[model samples]
Target chain A: MKLFQKMGAALPSAKKLVSGLLDESQPPVEEDQGGFGPPGGVLWTTPLDVLSDRPKAGLPTQSAINAPLPEPAPALPPDSPDRSEALERTGLLCTDIEATSEIGGFIGACLVDSGSGLVLAETGDGRIDMEAAAALNTQIVRAEHEVIEVLDLDDHIEDILITMGKQLHFIRPLEKSPGVFLYVALDKKQANLGMARMQVGRIESTLKM
Target chain B: MSTDIAATTEIAGFIGACLVDSESGLMLASEGGGKIDMEAAAALNTQVVKANLQAIETLGLNDGIEDVLITMGKQLHMIRPLEKAPGVFLYVALDKKQANLGMARMQVKKIEGGLSL
Candidate 1:
């Protein structure tokens, strides 16, 4: 239908077409009826209050909601010159992937502790001031965490994205590891989000820390 | 350089979509990154998304954005953070020659409207 309009062709009754589309597109909702009543057919089956708050579906068990995570990560060594090694040396995780194979001359990488809003470890650069990244990222993680709680579902967060003129920023939560995140900064000109996600997925498969 | 995401989605045809989550690096939900292994993608892309999210937040806008676009010689990247959704985002990429970024966001917005959570 949109194509017909583009081809210098006369559209066939745009009003009728749109009205038909609306009927198919608009799902019946309690919020839409006269004064917030249940959908057309819902009232006959269940109480209006019970039908309105229906969850999306397949909710996980309560035990899974607050399931105890594997022990919290170890404290970061304040002065360890080698950040990645320091994180690993804490004897908390078995982060054994060699940086060379994982990143391959990548510009920079870091693990920001989402809880404390601090940089736990960074690789490929000595002067990035990742601490700043941590502090800034903390507020974001906190805000979203609140929203997620409001939604009342505990499926761990996956990732966040920030796009710009010349850079592509990606935030991925270590869902298997809470309050710990993997931050990847990309040259907007160089990285492809599709390809980047694929490569990063491979790297994390073996990257425990 | 079309600003319409719906047209872009129709023309470029990305497999996945990307959204921002009021943050620089949060690649919320993307189209074609594949089920390559959610854990790895989440971990690595997390950094990329975070880096960008912070940069925007630090600018002192004191406000968030609807979406951001990156156009390369060969590709187009799309990011839309649900201003109301907060942490969730939508990420998308399309071929430059084929995409009309102008409509990509529109398509994404339509998708978001139907989103449950």
Candidate 2:
């Protein structure tokens, strides 16, 4: 089918980026294993208690890409707030990449929650169905944990790139804690997969939670 | 996409009217979708999406589905299932004139992986 062909075309480039990720010097298998295992499985706690523990985590008190207010202090905070910030960061990240429209359609993008099928973040046009979209993408964070395990591929799937038609879809999973993965979606139509992989790669390096 | 919410807003806004993440009940990006309760709409639609995925698994059709659509007399519900993540879905509502159904569905399918989610 046409879709398979596009996915085939983009695979190699995505594979190359994975090979060249930030911690690539180690080994492909261990690339996404930075803070392996959640210290406390903190990403899903309720908002109230999570907010109370903010100061301890070293993250901004109040956040959002469009928050009008100055960024608050950064201390070791709790989980939910950190997750909000992560989601907010993802929104800001796409702003920076600046994918233009006039060019053509994007590849594919998704923000998948590996743990409970929760899409923490995502951005893409209209081609794929959201119902099928989120369930299909298996790239980032905790979502791919099982895939990696079952497939016998020991590496952590920081990002998985698949090309369809002329576009490329980049699935980058974020490690919020042990159990939660912040999913990031990207469109190859307006995105340069090479640069996109690297751009998101940098964001991962500076993550706080 | 969370990355370019503003751009997505301006762009998607120009197209259909609004976009919202069906799960987690958040507006990841939106262009236009009339006076619909993006949150409630997303929540209710979860059933439609869930059934399809379950069907795929039950039928052993693991070929991977990209997007699906539900058309009503008044509106069209565009559902895109991300190929990367397993259970999340992007729900977009369009006011017929605001978008070209065929193109919007195609565009949503095409723009899946610019964000790293």
Candidate 3:
């Protein structure tokens, strides 16, 4: 009996539910507004649409977009010898001396201060003592100066060459920098003195100070 | 004995040349110096030779000097100690523009060989 009574009450609720769905499917029609419907006719709005209505102060202007971008720093060539960091401390570049190591029979090379006998920069094959050579060669420079004074040879020392039984030593004072010299030791058998001197002169010209 | 250094005139771009005694810095024979004072050069070059010798000895190179060459801005100077004579040396100067260093060295070496003193 109780089950029959509950069935009777549930049937009316089911009928009411069907009528609600039918009403939703037959919604009242309105005049077509073409594809360009009313502005607020959208069911839901996107974040872009919401923000688009606001001020554009933070956005880039048309002129800003058309302007050229800043250029990247210019790159150095692969074989360029100017090493800026190493060159900063002293005007004498080690890369310049390293270029001298490319000579045919280069035993060693150094840049020396003729006044104080200091080895500013050097590169070598360990066959020669650059420090002692720098100091001794300073004396040679000084002696040459004395000779110049005694002879009244109104000139400066360009270079001094020492030819030994098996070796050749070259000392060239930088024309731009006073009291600074480039010293190179080479094997006599493998080096051409003329070419070596020419190359050394070329390298000396590139030195700034 | 002094050599006939007059033979050195044949060298190309020859400016001046002399044979100097390394001890007293005196020229024994000389040839072809227009504006250059050969006497002063010979006397001054002797010190260069001595200093080179001292440098060689101090470095303990255990070898004798073959030659000492000074390359000046306008000139090339060569100081070669004679093999036959212990205390005598040959000094020659050349104009850098016209002189060939290798040829000059060879000619100078040959002249040094013919020198008796």
Candidate 4:
């Protein structure tokens, strides 16, 4: 009689469960597949005990996002000569000549090609005609060369100085770059010849082709 | 005068000396000789002088050229325009090791003062 009473009580609960499973309106319980959740599901849906967790669709794991980025390369020095900017080099040379205080009474200056009498670069006030000066000075240099050849002096010309009552002119031929020279003009009263010569030498040493 | 040329020739290490008419590129008188051809040197130096004069005129500095000195490794060339004769010049070349620049300049100036033409 007791066994029959227990069966009768369990039969009602079993019937309710069966009805709930068969109902079409009720949602099915989703099984967690070893932490490999369904598409578009949360990444951490798997429990810690799951051993075969697979990557979720279209998403990176936490480790990749936290990885450090590669470092940037080192920078170059500002005034390194290895840099290959030709125009900048010429511009800086002119700036250096303009800023040097040792070349007093600085009326004007130019770099000239001795062969063709062409002005490669020039900087100065409008009072001085650098083009004419370059062309004429080229003739002077050529004449000197001829004299040297005729005399067979077995020497090289370092520099030439033309002194006038009111002005002084200098022409220094470049030893490394033949057929080129530096021409500078200054006022006699304001310039120191020795200092100007030294400054010109320094400038020539640093000039690039 | 001939005596002035003699004095210029007597300077130590004097390789050559010439009186040039820079306006015409002519050598009026020449003394001493080594490897340099005085005639050619006179004509070439005249071109240098003319170029200098033109440069000064173009710049409009209203200045007269007094002298031009060319420094070389083994030699020194000096070109001085005659004060009395505006178009004339004295050209001299000397060995750098044997010549004293100050003394050479003084002697050249003295010769110029005594020169007749």
Candidate 5:
């Protein structure tokens, strides 16, 4: 049976009272030949009182009226970390390589560990064996270090530029991290060496450990 | 003395010079002498040239390398791949105190131009 029908069956007197309140045109209680009353002859002063005080016949009587309303869902903390920001921080290295590759006449680019010559990341066509290149460049950097010590010139390496008949190579060791460096190749005819060098400097500034 | 020797002798601070085949990393001809090892320098510089070529190829850029300059505390190293000779390059080292970059570059260009191979 429907809940409302069951409720009506349990509270016949209250149901009649509610109906009377809904229709004012109905005969007054005193004039009506059959006025509504409880089955045991109890009287109700008002319908609201019965609704508030009485429990339904078949429903459980476990302080339903005093049950606390469900608490509103808890809100997120104000200082919660942003997911995108974390991702951007983690992906910063790859983004640096991509930005470098976008320069005009870009051939290949790599981030290498200067001490070990291990390639951390590389972006280039397969034509250039980056592994061999990184290893070889490490030797060149070491040779430069040896020359510096032997000559006692006190100056440091800023960058190395190798211009060829067909290409240009730029190598710059990271200032912040002395053990890592960036290398890039470019086409001679298409790349502006000055602009390319400037772009590399900018990228170096943003590279994180 | 060969042409390579004669050419290198004219430079004021000419420490050493070598013509290296970039593909093989082998020294074709060499002249002069200094603390810098000509054979080792030529081989290492050839790798530099090859690496540059690989980088350009990987970048898919339709261009060429004109020359490369390395400045050190006491010396300057220059590498220039020949235009007529695709796989060969000239590697030259100069004493910074005695070498004039403008003059050295002009002399190297002239020597490269005069070379038969």
Candidate 6:
């Protein structure tokens, strides 16, 4: 008798799955209908009932909503140093120009942006107008480049030396830092050209971009 | 004159050389210019010479220029005015890697001594 009861319970769904319109007495699958509520019939059922029965994917559950908030974003790095100060330390270009002053017979030294003809940094006595020199020297550099272009000299300028009666003006375009140059004015009598060139090259190597 | 200028090629690391009349900014002779336009260089280098002279006068340095040296990443350029011939100058370009600046200077001086024009 129990086997007959089990077969009776399974017969309707088996017939419904086999033939879509075979069962007129049974209504469509629904939550309250109980037609495909559990066990074997649940396999052929729509996803609506399954999703409502359990939590939807990716949404917060009751426990997740009740749990403590995530430690307040890790507390903003206690005593974060001023950004400009850090930048200043990282960019040693200005301070590096200062080292040029130690060169023998140094009258003035300035770092110029070749593209804009602006003085990025300057140090030395007030004998030379650093701003003017920066702008004018930019022209000199451009002229040299033009000459190179016209001459088809497949090369770049390392440095230019203007040996005056009393002073020697040295201009070096930084190899690592393109579009920027170092200008150092030295007393011709006191400064050794070879040594000064070596020193400038060393400083250029040490420059942190 | 071109043959006289060609003597500069004997210098170590010699690239190109020319003799220019600074007043006219024209080349009297040129040799081994490679791809370089020696004519333009002659004219432009004259400007450099003139500028240095003007700078000396303005500063009241009362000193005559020995030479103007342009050191490049790949090449070295020396502009020396002829003592015997006023308004004429010698310009030479050399490979920086192989050039001995002192020796190159001496060679330029020697060549200048022999060059009469």
Leading candidate by lDDT? 3
DockQ scores of the candidates? 0.04, 0.02, 0.36, 0.53, 0.17, 0.33
* iRMSD of all candidate structures: 11.0, 17.1, 1.9, 1.4, 5.1, 2.6
Candidate 1 residue-wise lDDT, A66-175, digit = tens: 54432322333566444444334433354432342344324556677787887766664543455676677666666545433442323344555555454554566664
Instruction: Tell me how many clashing residue pairs each candidate has.
Output: 63, 100, 0, 0, 12, 0
lDDT per residue (tens digit) for residues B1-117 in model 4? 432566787777798899999888999988886878889889989988887887778767788987898988888888988888869998988888898877887898888777766
By TM-score, is 4 or 6 better? Answer: 4
Q: Model 6, DockQ value?
A: 0.33
Q: How well is candidate 3 docked (DockQ)?
A: 0.36
A1-209 per-residue lDDT for model 2 (tens digits): 33233334433433443333213253323222222222221111122332343465565444322334322223333454543444343332222222322223443344444555654444446445544556554222222343234423334544444333334444444544433333234443566645655665565444432
What are the chain A TM-scores of the candidates, in order?
0.50, 0.39, 0.56, 0.54, 0.55, 0.58
lDDT of 5 by residue, B34-110 (tens): 56667777667776676656655654545677777776656777777777886888878888899987788788888
**Which segments of model 6 are wrong by more than 4 Å?**
A1-86, A92-95, B1-6, B50-64, B83-86, B113-117
Q: Between the candidate structures 4 and 5, which one is better when assessed by DockQ?
A: 4
Q: Indicate the docking level reached by candidate 6.
A: acceptable
Error of 6 at A68 (Å): 30
Tens digit of per-residue lDDT, candidate 4, span A72-185: 223335454433232243232332355433489888888898989988778887668889889988988887887787767777888998889988888988767757898888
**In model 2, which runs have C-alpha deviations exceeding 4 angstroms?**
A1-209, B1-33
Model 1 alpha-carbon drift over 4 Å, by segment:
A1-92, A95-106, A125-128, B1-54, B57-106, B109-117
Candidate 3: what is its chain A TM-score?
Answer: 0.56
The lDDT per prediction is 0.48, 0.42, 0.74, 0.72, 0.66, 0.72
Sort candidate 1 into its docking category: incorrect
Q: For candidate 3, write residues A94-163 as lDDT tens digits.
A: 3358888987789999999887998988999877788888888888788778766775656788989888
Q: What is the lDDT of candidate 2?
A: 0.42
lDDT agreement of model 3 with the native: 0.74
Clashes of 1: 63
